[model samples]
Target: MIGRIRGMFILGLCSASALAAGTGYQPPFHPDQLKGPPAGRPNEVLVLGSPHLSGMPDTFAPAQLEPLLERLAAWKPEAIAVEAVSGLQCDYMRRNPARYADSVSSYCVDTGPAQAATGLDVPAANAEAERLLAQWPATPSAAQRRRLAAVWLAAGERNSAVVQWLRLPAEQRIAADGMTDALVAFLDKRLQRRDESVLVAATLAARLGLERVWAVDDHTADSPTPKEVEKAAADAITKAWDNPYSKARAAADIPLYANVAQPDGLLAIYRAYNAPESAMQTYRSDFGAALVEPSPQAFGRNYVGYWETRNLRMVANIRDVVGQTPGMRLLAIVGASHKPYYEAYLNLMHDVQLVDAEDVLR
Candidate 1:
């Protein structure tokens, strides 16, 4: 709670002025003040804001993430969530290409082969994956793990599939239990990519002996915009972002990204990214700037709306996972740009106790 605010049970309506600055009215109640079921342990969530690994410099090596990973491993999160669209959402978007065609191409994996191998589409595969895990043994054989991987892949949860693949013994990584040869090859190749979900989240899950990583990212807010409107929105936002704060952020990031492969370099970058001041810096540079851009169509408002909607849905997806099990510990890995919004919005939940990212990184 170093930088977080706890809800106040008392409303200060009696004495002092709670008057307006612009349109000020302090609410009568705080949901966070309402708290839990009054029984079991409260849910703890640690949101780790990560730089998208796919955007790292050419010199970036997966091994460089070790120090950062070690600290998170010590945290011992029971459930891990990553910033990737769930296969279920991807399937819905795929059907309506008029709106989400581009998003699908950018965010979703092609699960056709795995679907064919498992004879299950995204929903069916997700169901089967749940069924198998419901009856999953305390100690499963290699074939069981392999089948789970195949099933997860078909479910559009490739990162979770990677977790299953890593858990299997080296010799046990074969096509068995509905795992086709082509699917195994696909998993092997995809496993080698430098995605944070793979190298960090899934890797940590495997080390912790967890069954799978959660895909809690969302793009359902996306809708097709006309070409002309897209250009106008992009230009307006770009102009807003040309501020001193944005420039300063770029200046700091250049050095951090440059030194990431050096000893303990990755740790420094994460510390800087997770600092409390960084959130304000983000607002000043990005969202805050965009909020005031005087676009005729209110394009700035549209962009901000899309961003908030997307984050809200993503957090809801996470809430779904943590809700199923009381007192669960969840670690969410998302882009640094998303950190502030995630923490601020999640703070409103009654049962949630937000863990300081700074403390965890420390």
Candidate 2:
């Protein structure tokens, strides 16, 4: 039976032209191919898979990240994208709280203080940020950076605000321009957060002389489960995760997280996470198990569907920026689980070339 199924799949590939003749359902083109002979510059994307620093083992020192940061700095990415939802999306979600209340509460920065300070709401502040950046000077004044930082904060993008703030010299990072004392305090607080978005992406961007980091994470796929099915869905999925593959997954990763404070331990952690087999392991453990879940409500399939939908939208957001400026070296930092999906989806872009994460880490 397996041999027969494999033969049928092979025949489907050979039957691509059959679809044009209206005789088969096979797809005619694979987007992963069709790379051009020449372009101004290929859009090279290097995705770094990372553990959430906020959840790292207690032994993990924030200073231990310096070596990893230095290595990535050497890659010279022109643009950096972090796993964060944009302010615009958050603003929209906030207005429709019935569907997004949980997401807003969990992932979004409360921009109220910054909005009051700037007298601009989310959309206005985000637009003003774009306008200022459009013609940002070769050498901006300290006040200019401070003002941009304020605008970014009002837009619900604290990481980008941190980028702007960090670019300024310590003495100049003061309450001027639109930066009120409270807003300044907000950004100062962000610098101390151990989350990957701040500790890694924002810090790296500032060191690389970039003015702003991009927030491309999506929570639009997130919605409260219907009350009727919520508990059953949760129980079913939890049971599915209590499997052998999942146990092995934890076994392999627990040690990696524990030793990150040691010399070269981070590089080891990265290489293991970015290994070619890591994606398959994720499938065998998480999504794949969820997919085959036998619940009558099809809870596992729903879980898998959500995962794919989230990754699809996340990749689409990344593509939006990659399309705007072709031929630039871009870096995307995301959770380890998202790396494979990001790469698979990005490879479908006609112009994007995926740089091996292992190579970058090496």
Candidate 3:
């Protein structure tokens, strides 16, 4: 079906409604309209670009995102995908404990402790977290809040812990997952990290009573970079960002994040990001940057290969989800870098319609 806009551009009801009615409009008809029947069913998809919250400096406050998250919740997405890899966060921690050793030790209070304390695996803990959020007491006792926090932490969802904690009154946000002052401080600090976006997704899902957030990010396409090639590639990527277009865009974008609390600040940035031109920015910043490689080195090709492969796989994951549930409205929340790639790849799928995120974000 051809997509239709609604409840917008309400300039004059008589003319606008008459034109939108499609009877009196009769605007230039395409020859293809007569040439063919419709294709597959359309599934709405929105790819939202967000800055990696973990990378935000100390000045970046988590509270500023509440309004934006509230706005997105209004979209009433049936399915939501996030940048995190699917499965328990501890799976990654178990496989590469060193990678997350610091964060886990700091915030994930005594790994597996919650599972041991509650005998609940990740899925089970997630279920409990949902139940607790849904049935949260009007004025929860200290013990009750601690139980919810422990379950959330056990799920390796410190982000969700922060989310639930933020839902509490300031006086009630004490250390509850094992209840140490150090853990309380660390939990607040975790809220500042990259997982803040995950927190937003989790909070929205909870508000909508969604069972789980889908993880569609693909990292299998990433090849191990040789040290020599890595150094050169890093420099090339840096220079690409230094290019005039990149510089100007960065200058414009930084202010949006800096002033995110102001009205329409985040929406303006989201609108700019989802515009058609933003795809070219991704091309230049990512795939095109590798073109700077000198002759005889295919390093740039490797970069493009990795980028395209990752995006294709990610889109495949999304398509699989949509295929299972026809007419599903999906929202994929991902890093700013991935937004264009996701839209470009998902748009080609016959059944998937890339919803204009500008329309939704606005």
Tell me which of candidates 2 and 3 scores higher on TM-score: 2
Q: What is candidate 3's lDDT per residue for 1-362, written digit by digit as tens?
A: 00011111111222212223335655685432342122544578888887666665555555666666777888888888876554354455446553444333433334365576667777788777778868876666666766776676666665545555555567877755454565567567765555634566866775775545676765443333454555565554455446666676777778777766666565566667777787787667555655454423444444555566667888888888888888788888887777887876776676677777777766
TM-score of each: 0.92, 0.91, 0.65
Question: How does model 2 fare in lDDT?
Answer: 0.83
> What 10-residue stretch in candidate 3 is worst by lDDT?
1-10
Compute the lDDT for candidate 1. Answer: 0.84
Candidate 2 residue-wise lDDT, 110-208, digit = tens: 998889889989999999999999999999989899999999999988899999988999888788888988888878888888888888899999999
Q: Which stretches of candidate 3 lie over 4 Å from their true place?
A: 1-42, 55-60, 88-111, 118-196, 239-242
Q: Which portions of model 2 show Cα errors greater than 4 Å?
A: 1-24
Per residue, candidate 1 scores C-alpha lDDT tens digits across 1-362 of 10010001012221222223586677999987777764788899999988888888898888998998899999999999999888898999899897678679878999899888889999999999999999999999888898899999999999999999999887888989878888888888878898899999999999999999999988776665665555565677788889999999999999999998899888888899999999999999988887677766665556666677778888888888989998999999999989999998888898888999899888
| lDDT, residue 7, candidate 1 | 9
What are the candidates' C-alpha RMSDs? 7.2, 7.3, 13.3
| Higher-scoring candidate on lDDT, 2 or 3 | 2
